[model samples]
Target: MSRHIDLAVIGAGPAGARAALEAAHRGLSVTLLDEQPKPGGQVWRAKSAAILDAPPTPETEAGNRLRQSVQDSRVTHLGEARVWQIERAEDGWKLHVLRDGRSSPLRARALVIATGAREFVQPVPGWSTPGVLGLAGATALFKQDLALPGQRTIVSGTGPLVFFVAAEIRRLGGAVAAVITPNSRGDWLRVLPGMLQRPDLLARGVSWVADLMLAGVPIHWRHAVSAVDGGSAVEAVSFRKLGADWTPTGEARRMSADSLCLGNGLIPTVEAAQLAGVELEHCPELGGWVPRHGEDGTTGVPGLFLCGDGAGIRGAAAAEIHGRLAGLSAAQHLGADTRAERARLHPGYVRAARFGMAMTALSTPRAGLAQLTTEDTIVCRCESLTRAAIAAEIAGGANSTNAVKSGLRAGMGACGGKFCQTAVARMIAKAEGRAESDVPPPTARPPLRPVPVAALAGDFDYFDLPIPRPAPL
Candidate 1:
């Protein structure tokens, strides 16, 4: 019996459905949460309403107006729920959540966290085959199971999601076979004079490179995909030539493809903002260790905020202007907006926080991509470990990510590591000069709802109550 709120949010994505539709249109009551039963998280993901009544695709019409602003009435949504931790209580933040198999407790005053951003995948060498995948898990299996893990895909990566997964695999007709991009068209012509000072983001990056060059595909650029042949599923890949500190070079071509779609970009899912302690800040141009926020997404935890791409990898129109400046700084921190309506919403939130700091300094990543791993690759695919056992636990001294998860437990399996804990905490903070927020992150317990220990021992409530009858005896 917990469930209370003023604004809980968590994530329904598209920055918690536009910060729960601008804090329930400024009246605030919200609740939102989501493990996704729908409400576009993985970049506008809903589907099934016969694919949401098919038709619209200005990216599913802003995720169908953020799922009709979470069906209004001061929002509640909850979808599949999940949450997991967030604590602070005495009268404000509890959270916990999880769903269906129960385990509740909510209560809020303002928490937002529009928890979003995943997909970085760096292990390589036939990346756990079975049709590879993860340009956002093949665009969330072509947006919610219309499914198309094959039929000759390739779509390697760098950013702007490999040209939006090769324009959603050419709008589902499939057969991409190229789009490689290890980011060097001379680093996109040196970020095109800072992307031509945003002529509408350089005309939507020149209309997504003119719809992947009129869907004839084949873009390659300094290429990448180093090795991914195939035995059981993905058919071929290999490529090379990246050099100038992005690595990969000399002779390797291959390319056949039956699904590869890699990724090397997104990061900030900051596990519920580092389980509510907030304050992180590596900012390798905003993708690793994010949440230090401000300019109205207010972090350093004071009624907790953080918006879009978990407050980093800024995309989706700067996550809808950082979800309208975290719903007008949480409606001016609950006095219900009016410092002249947040000074007339401060110049469109400082022009979407300076166009999300120039697209996070022109899509950062690419620092020799941690020497694209080798030493029999596989860095913690759920503790299978190797990359020479995380460089022999950073050459033993285990320097932070809780001392390399106590020397190579490497984020102790079962994805509590959340896909190899930020590339094993940025390769142990670049081999221990130390400071990816001095490492820490990796402990978010609770069945924050996975349940099914045989459905919690067949719904046992200490063998189904009724013991009070002994008092009557």
Candidate 2:
């Protein structure tokens, strides 16, 4: 008696939300499933009604519009449903879902994966401590729950997210000890001329950095956090200077702070796609191994598409455009739209995707990251693999992440390899003298979120609902 949907979008982030709303508007029945309790993915993580009712900030208002648009009767919002797998059935695909200690299945004519991405953490000394958190985690605590992790916080790492986190912390009336960025001001200068092609975006980026400077938040360029010092929680951090190649020069210094927020970058959550048999490729510029997606979000599998960070790490704007293109493509495949409609949407999608590609290429992880690790540093907290162990594995002819993982069991942890995979891949790549993109990532399986077997057994009919059939001809 499982319910059937015309389109089942397996994420409620910007991409999935846009796809669901667009598909529903085009006279298709849509079901939106998200692991979280609300619609907004990590980027827009706020309470559903709470966000809608709040006096609109410019940021909140845009989300408000999108939220209101997706509230139509044709859309069924299934919050808290964790999809374990997507298997190709005789007709379309079957999605096995687990919800609240129960299991159920649903069939959909088409599927759009917008599972999004997660923050990439490079293991450093004391990274696993209680007070130490990822940049995104800190943002989530402040934005969603209006809670601060500590009174004083040091946000470190590279990329635009570091600045965003610092702004949020300062906005929340928390003391920002410093914004430590590994990228030098010269790095920004090198990318600035190219960024000038989009004056508006350049202006916005400059304004963000300028605001931080005006607020007296010390911006440390060419510096990286080497270690976090604390017993049960983070109390201070050690930083080292990077040379021209981005390697730490032997010089180091320390700063006292209550919390250490670190993030190297983000990687696409491709578990669902991989489980569905989607082909993956290692694109260092776009995180690690991401699914090979076409320009219009179509995967090699028919009726299956990827959009947003799940496809690769593009910002929210690009994710939205990709979602719309995927929805249009799905509609065309379903005979819901004409050829002309598809043709019209194609050009806009291309332009946005090109912009995303350029941004991704320029901001890709630098080579200097490998120099951050020390022999005593833990590589995998879950498996207790030390840097020495990984180095030994690489020296012993393990050239890829899988081989290194099998040799040292670095990624076989409770978190399902999320934390250790990137670091392991990078280490293997460096040892073998291969491009980071040459190292294949581990196979992604399900259940996407770890569920206790007890919970699965208790709720056998969790995903069960009456199936809806079309009217007879």
User: Which lDDT values do the candidates have, in the order given?
Assistant: 0.73, 0.78
Report the lDDT of model 2 for residue 128: 81
What is the C-alpha lDDT profile of model 2 across 1-473, one tens digit per residue?
Answer: 18877888999888888888777878898888998887778877754444444444444555556666766447888889988878997778899888877778899999889989888877778888788889889878765666677888888977777887887777767888988887777766766654555566667767768888999989888788888999988889999887877678876789999898898878888888998889998876666678989756788998888888888876677788778777777776677763565577667666555555545544467787666778878878888888898888889888877787777777677877888888888887777788876777787666677777866576356459677898899
Q: Which pairs of residues collide in candidate 2?
A: 102-459, 104-463
lDDT of 2 at 238: 91
Candidate 1 colliding pairs, count:
1
Give the alpha carbon lDDT tens digit for every residue of 89-133 in model 1.
Answer: 876688877678666678888788887877777777768778887
Give model 2's clash tally.
2
**lDDT for residue 453 in candidate 1, whole number 0-100:** 57
> Against the hidden true structure, what lDDT does model 2 obtain?
0.78
Error of 2 at 19 (Å): 1.2
Q: Which runs of model 2 end up more than 4 angstroms from their true locations?
A: 48-56, 193-201, 354-363, 458-473
